[model samples]
Target: MSCLTARTGRQRQRYEGHLRLVSGCIPYKFEKSVGGSNCSTEKDLLVLMISSPSRDDLVFPKGGWEDDETMSEAACREAWEEAGVKGVLGETPLGDWEFRSKSKQNSCSLQGGCRGFMFAMEVTEELDSWPEQANYGRKWLTIEEAYRACRYDWMREALKKFVTALPESRENDTIKELEERPLRPISEVEHQMPSQGCFGSHPSIQQLAA
Candidate 1:
């Protein structure tokens, strides 16, 4: 069932030192042209972006990594609550970004610093109404428009990584590919984060907050 209410309060919010850890995704879907015709290329892929209630610019759905839920769960919940969409989240994150938040308690070493992890979601369903639908207006944009609409340097950079990581955007070498194992997952965060470790996805103590 879909949640009708958005979660609130920072009481259970998790923090690594002074920086708040946030999670979100670039929700995307494949489509044909406005007519019921098949897409010739991958150019028809669309990304969903939501309006920031406090700003004129659009932003991907994101929110706090509360103590109770896994980072991936938080990311998925934020997308559903804010943008009214649900989909499969990529195994690896698109990228991590440090940005400043307008909220006094969140930032990227500026005022209130925040460290955010973003993933690519292959959106499967969309709802007519969501928890934050009244505050966040959703729009579907092409990759080019999404890039131009980005309001922050980090957002743009993360978007670039997202594009690069897309399987459709890759070029293959046939001979080299023939020798490689197909089981290997394409992951960028793994090599760059040998020591940092991913924020665990499950198996938490499931602490209850009073």
Candidate 2:
């Protein structure tokens, strides 16, 4: 089935570059992370995570997949839009885990759909400044600390895998280290169902918080 492809110029550029490299795609979306720890005598690795204001529970920076957008493209957009950070997304997927919303009645799920893919990418650059999106609370914590901070076991597991696999630091935003995989077409049912439109129909983080 053909996937929905409607990203802007820059987004399209990023998506195309990664799609050229990675041939196939995976359906059944989940959450992913690429975390590391610099723990020692002084301080531990500080990674940022957020909690939904409505639910008031900790969550990693992640979101649903975009139509035809490669894993890297979706990861970067989720990080940027949710965390307000500027960095190159990693290509090597750390891990993928499944999760369900606390409420199946979530605005998006109620109106659109609920399927998503969880993928991780390396952060190439950290912007000196950025603005936090609406109703989101962010915090920096050690990898271990993040485990306690996150609300779900699956989220903690994803973070742990990322922490173990993450490199020392962000060095290059443009260089992609992972070899490309075959790109698979998104399922037709995914596009027609309300689950996929879940977020689009309800475009407020407030619902997440609520």
Candidate 3:
């Protein structure tokens, strides 16, 4: 016998048989200097990791996607709510991963399973406090460190993809220029897909670079 059943009528369905859909962001930033040099260095890319509220494991900031917001918007909102950071969100998800949630009763899966869409967010500002501040602790870690510290194997793969796609190095002048430039609010930025197709139709890394 199946453990799942669809709910009828206007009451929103909570679970979808054996899986729940979720969205999240992988917040990252390029370290501005290396060994006291005033220029930026791509070798020092860092990703933000947060302490999970239910356990001591380190994980990226992510949460459920609200119906009112797009997937990208939900990822950005989760970053701000959970990590107190803000910045430009990639126009598309870098990739996705599936995991079993610890809190299974609230999820649609009989096993508490969930699938997450993960996007890359270039962090521009870090706030002193956030909504989840009391429940989570945040830290910035280098690529290798983040990979090793990640609580799940799927997250490690995502980190690897991010590292592989990053440029070997960036010009100091370009770094300085970007730093000097003011960043507009993410909401103001418009994302346009090339006539070629959506992100799924293109190379994952290339889409991220775009």
Candidate 4:
């Protein structure tokens, strides 16, 4: 016989959204000023890598922050560890941004677990090379180029504001070169999907027994 008890009769509801943790690091070098003659070849600004670890898809230099470290420390450490450069982190955090990932699972807490932070900073030196274990590489790009490379709204906005404030940036003109350009939609593969209850840990339903 089918059970029709109070608990069995009602349909179960599940959390609709997944939690995520993310961060951002902005670095700029000194390469004289753009659009100026007799400018030194040395790079003036550092454009953090905008690529994803799983693929060549570009993304700003950032990653998950460990429990023991502060957001500031995470940003600085990621810059060195991912880009192979060192510098003083920005005094205040720029802000926090969000993104969804379908690959998120129990092992990836920040992916579909909780909110995340975006930290800012200024670089003190040019990186000759990244950490030995770092699989990522750094690139130097114009403010316009950097903006074009980013996909997320939050990341693009952050890069634009920071680049515009630079002494070398032009006045009156806000955007560098994003007006006429085309942007491919966020990749389907990157979109966050519903969990299959692999860990039996629903976002809202914490394990009370454990």
Candidate 5:
């Protein structure tokens, strides 16, 4: 719920020894049906795009993953920081993409390349203003438009993979569920489940038997 709470003070120098790993979110929202159109069956997907601070290119929300947070957390944090949006992060990453960092001060400066983990984030809320609002501009575009507008080839590929994995109808359902509930991490949900056979011990199973 908190966006841009962490200070960007100084880039940590510790990652200078290894290849920089970044986490990012592909933020998406369901576009409402047109006034004249039937709402029952129509579902449109729109992806959020952010303008890069130093360039004219439009890119997804992404940043370096800190030592203290999980990859999902980092992706969610980046989405909030860069795009001023909050949502449920997907349990699995869409894929990894390799890119060369332009920042000379970071670890990628020496390595010349960085690995990015991309995940799907169903946008539930959008803030009026965000920390990087002055530096970045946000827009929502259709899948094809977003793909063509992407600044990096690797990112385009990631978008393609995410789209291919979830067709329009299924994606609509997923987005609806995320918006309806505050999703917990898959790990936490699994830990709370009873360790018994599917037909044993569970209340639902007992009711069915009765």
Candidate 6:
């Protein structure tokens, strides 16, 4: 069995007023294009999405932002638990959106409303199995496919921010860059990185450049 396990219950869940604080991420990576070394064009970009056990639709990995961790760490944790993948977590958030929780069983104390923060994850490692593998099946989709598959407008907006921040035309945007960095959980590295809000500095993407 995998040593990693998903967190259960919401004992450490954090909230503000009536809205629960939640964190999630759009996990993305680049595949080899026609040229090989450099990833060129939008088609090379692939974002990971996970299936919800309670719903037929797919969603990015996310959950309650526990009081013990920063929102960025919470976002990375969700991606690790739900999607079974890890990479360089962006220092900044793609954005925050207020939306209703789709599953009451999974919601925090605030009924169905949630104030969610999202970050862009540059996927560095893809595991053979994960903590929530039985609960959430993961799939990678191209940017265009992900847009159509997005069930919520906010998720789509997060994705828009991700692509805008790192368009394919940008120089030195390659899978090699992220892969060069050592792999470590966000918890271990969070101290060295800046703690950012929904709106912060230019996003630091951890990708195949992972």
Candidate 5, run of 10 with poorest lDDT? 191-200
lDDT of each: 0.69, 0.41, 0.62, 0.50, 0.64, 0.70
TM-score head-to-head 3 vs 4, winner: 3
Tens digits of lDDT, candidate 3, 88-129? 776667777778876664666467677777877777788765
Decoy 2 TM-score against native: 0.51
Q: Which ranking of candidates, highest lDDT first?
A: 6, 1, 5, 3, 4, 2
lDDT per residue, candidate 5, 1-210, as tens digits? 443464474264124345678888788877766554454645788888887766656788888877777777778878877788887666677888767776643553456566788887778788776767667778787675666566566876677666655544344344344336553332231111111100111111111100
The residue-level lDDT of candidate 3 at 69 comes to 61
Give the clashing residue pairs of candidate 3, or none: 15-108
lDDT by residue (56-136, candidate 6, tens digit) is: 566788999999998878887788788888777777677788998886646556687889888787788877677777778
- On residues 28-103, what C-alpha lDDT tens digit does candidate 2 reach at each position? 1112454458533332245666556566455666654555665556666556555544443334455555445455
Each model's RMSD to truth, in Å?
Answer: 12.5, 16.4, 14.0, 15.8, 14.6, 12.1
TM per model?
A: 0.73, 0.51, 0.67, 0.61, 0.70, 0.73
Task: Kindly report which residue pairs in candidate 5 clash with one another.
Answer: none
Error of 1 at 12 (Å): 0.9
Q: How far off is residue 61 in model 3, in Å?
A: 0.4
What is the clash count of model 6? 10
Q: Distance from true position, residue 152, model 6, in Å?
A: 1.1
Off by over 4 Å in 6: 35-43, 104-110, 169-210
lDDT of 5: 0.64
